[model samples]
Structures are given as C-alpha cells and as structure tokens.
Target: MRVLVVMGSKSDFHIAEKVTGILDEFGIDYDVEVASAHRNPKRVEELAKKDYEVFIAIAGLSATLPGVIASYTTKPVIGVPVSAKLRGLDALFSIAQMPPGVPVAAVGIDNGKNAALLAIEILALKDESLKKKLEEYRERMRS
Candidate 1:
C-alpha cells in the first residue's frame, strides 16, 4: 500500500521523519511531500486524485491539512498535529474541532509514531503478514 505523508511546512520535516522511519522499518512504501493548505492548495488537490491508500497530514498552527485532504478524497486521512506555539492547544483545537461532515483521524501533537502505526492498521486490513506483524508489535509493546 502506498501511504502519503504530507506536511504543511518544511519545518515539520524533523518530526515527520520519524513517521518515515517507522514506515521504513515496516517495509512499507510511502511518498513524502510538503504541501501547504494555504500556499500549495493546488498541489494538495492534485495529490488527492493520485493513487494512495491513506494520508497522514502533519501540520501545526491552523492544522487544516487533514481536513483539506479529507475534503478532496475518500481515502482515510490521519491528522498529526505538530506542536506549535500556545503549547499545541492551537494545533489540537484546529484539528479536533472540525465541522460536521468532514472527519479526520487526529493523532497526538508530534506523535508520528502513532501515525505510522495507524497507517499500518489501515493497511493491515488486506495483508495477513502485516496484520500478524502489527499484532506482534502490539504484544511486544504490552509485554
């Protein structure tokens, strides 16, 4: 499955790279890009039409990347709110308070690890090996 990791700013690279690492460790193929909901809105609209099973949008501040993706595609979009000023309250509120209809699966502020895990969960639906690996991963975490 091809997963897309999109960030609103290049500044999110440091945090978002961890998600890249997790995907790499799982042997999952992914494409990473920086696309702004404000600046590169057209690019965002285009990627929405491409073939990707899921999207993980990592952004702070206004944090509308996930909602934008959700609006553009039927594929699942997971929002990872990178911590911004105001102790990430701004980020959390921006992501958590979505109006009716548009929904995004929001993860913790700067928690790219969970973002990767969530992506794996979604992909594991059709992959038995991936499902077993995820089960083992969770077991190791608990034990």
Candidate 2:
C-alpha cells in the first residue's frame, strides 16, 4: 500500500520525518509533499486525487489541509495537529470538528507516529504480511 504525506509548510518536515520512519519500518511506500490548503489550495486538491491508499495531512493553526484533502477524496485522511500557537488546540479542533460527510481522522498534537501507525493498520486490512508485522509490533509493545 502507498501513503501520501502532505504538510502545510516546510517547517512541518520534522513531523513528516517521524511518520516516514515508521512507514519505512513497516516497509510501506509513501510520498511526501509540502502543500498548503490556504496558500496552495490547487495543489492540495490536485494531490488529493492521486493514487494513494491513505493520506496523512500535517498542519498547524487553522489546520485546513486535512479537511480540504478529505473533501476531495473518499480515501482515509489522517490529520496530525502540529503544535503551533495556542498549543495546537486550535489545530486539533480544526481537524476534529469537521462538518458532516467529509471526515478526517485526527490524531493528538504533534503525533505523526500514531498517524503512520493508523495508516498502516488500514493498509494491513488486505495484506497478510502487514497484518503479521503489526501483530509482532504489538507483541513487542506488550513485552
């Protein structure tokens, strides 16, 4: 399975790096891009239509990236609320409080690791090897 990671700004690269590391650990393929819902709405809409099983959108402040992405595609979109001004609460609510129909799964503030894990879980649905990897990972966690 392939995942698309979109960040609202270049400053969010650190968070994206953590996500990519987790994806790499799971041997999942992914593409990362820097696009903004507010600054580059066209790019966000365009990328959302690409061939990807899941999408992880990282943004702070208004945090419109995830919602915009969800609007354009039916694919699962995970929102990572980056910690910016107001301690990321604004971003968290912006992602979590989506209107009906368009849904973006929102993770905790600055928690890209969980976002990647969630995407892996979704992809593992049809992949036995990935499911085994997740089970092993979970067993390790319990150890």
Candidate 3:
C-alpha cells in the first residue's frame, strides 16, 4: 500500500523525512507533496482523491494540514506537528482538538516518526501481511 505525506510548507521537509524513513523501513511506498492548508487547498483536495492508504500531514503553525485532509478523505490522517514559535503547542491544540466527527491522529511536534507508525497501524487493519510486518517491526524494536 501507499501513503501520502502532505506538508504545509517546504520548511517541514526535515520532519517529513522521519516518517518517510519509517515507511521505507517497512517497505511501504509513499509520495510526498508540498501543499499549504491555506495556500494550496486545491492541491490538497486533489491529493485526497488519489489512491492512498494514509495521509501524514505536517505543519508547524496551526496544524491545519491534518484537519483539512481528514475533512476530505475517508482514509486515515496522521498529523505531525512541526516546531514553531509556539514550540508546536498551537499545532498540538489545533490537531488534537479536532471535532468529534472528524478524527486526525496527532503525533508529537516534528516527529514524523510516530506519524509513520500511526499510518502503519491504520494500514494493518485491512492488510494481514502488512500487519505481520508491523508486528515483526515492533518485535525488532524491542530487540
């Protein structure tokens, strides 16, 4: 399966790399795009329509990326809060406090690593082989 990583700004690339690395480790394919929740909403909408197992939204200021993805897609959205002037507190609040109906699993600030893990978890739901791979990955982590 493939995942999509959408960053609100090009500056968030460093953080998105962490998630992409994890996907590589698991042998999962993914595509990355630079789009703003505000500046490039149309691209975001289009990406949501593409074939993707998960969407990792990374943004520093307001954490709007994940919510926007969740609003448009039935696929799972995992949010990576990037470091900001507020030290990502604003982003954390914005992502975590999503309305009850729309859910975006939020990760720690700048930790696309966790965002990737969350994506794997969601993918495992319908993929037995990937689920086993994930279990092995977790076992290896403890080893």
Candidate 4:
C-alpha cells in the first residue's frame, strides 16, 4: 500500500473515515489498522515496519501513536488529533511537540481530510499523474 492509516482505537474510526474518503477520491492506495501506542506497542511497531510510503496516525488523549510510529520508521508520518477530551487541545499539543530528529507533521484536531491531502501531496512529489490530479483538485477547490 502507498499509505497506512493507523488509529489508536476502533473509536477513532469516524476520524479515519474522513481520511480514507479523501484518499479514495485521490485514488491513493491505503490500509486502515487499529493499534494503540499504550495498549499495543508491538502492533504499532509491526505496522511501522511495513512498506507503506506514508503513515497517517489518528489518536487522542496522549496522542503518542504518531510519535511512536515515527520512531519506528523513516517514512513521513502525519498526525491527526481527535477530540476525545479536553476539546482536543491536549491531543494537539502532544502531536505537535515531537522531539528533534523524529519529526511528524501535525494536522489540526479532527482534521483527517487535511492529513490525507497532505499525504497525497507527498506522494505527488514522485508521481506525475498524482501531481496532475492534485492540481485539478486544487483548481476545483478554488472555483
């Protein structure tokens, strides 16, 4: 798969749907998996080791899933913070505050659509057809 969408729990599937919808519109290949950083670190590690070019990690509370994925892989990681509690500010901060070296791009809380768009943008860098599609998508948005 070109992209792997990992959620911390099944409860985050609603947010994951937002991400997958955009990916589907863009014709990007992706797989969705539920693995929590706290509850199942090994599963996260295994998922990270997969051959996907990009990862979109959806998590709330501590929001460590993205950072943990980043630690395991060199591929680009996009963090989508869910508003499970605290209006999602706490999740937002947790995602945004990754330490140096292991960098993860953070999107706005509950903004899975942007995360998918960003992932498509990254893939477009090496793909001419995807680049053209993105250009067309942006034009559609502008109109």
List TM-scores for all candidates, in order.
0.96, 0.98, 0.94, 0.99
TM-score of 1: 0.96
lDDT of 1 at 62: 87
Pairs with steric clashes in candidate 3: none
Candidate 4 lDDT: 0.97
List the global CA lDDT of all models.
Answer: 0.90, 0.97, 0.89, 0.97
lDDT, candidate 1, 1-143, per-residue tens:
48999999999998789899989988899999999999999999998778999899999988988889899898988899988887777887888888888888988889999999999999999999999999988898998
- Residue 23 of candidate 3: its Cα lDDT? 92
Query: Candidate 3, which segments miss by more than 4 Å at Cα?
Result: none
Which numbered prediction scores highest in lDDT against the true structure? Answer: 4
The weakest ten consecutive residues by lDDT in model 3 span 76-85
Candidate 4, superposed: residue stretches over 4 Å from native: none
lDDT of 4 by residue, 48-122 (tens): 999999999999999999999999999999999999899999999999999999999999999999999999999
Number of the top TM-score candidate? 4
Error of 2 at 115 (Å): 0.1
TM-score of 3: 0.94
Ranking by TM-score: 4, 2, 1, 3
lDDT of 2 by residue, 1-143 (tens): 39999999999999999899999999999999999999999999999999999999999999999999999999999999999989999999999999999999999999999999999999999999999999999999999
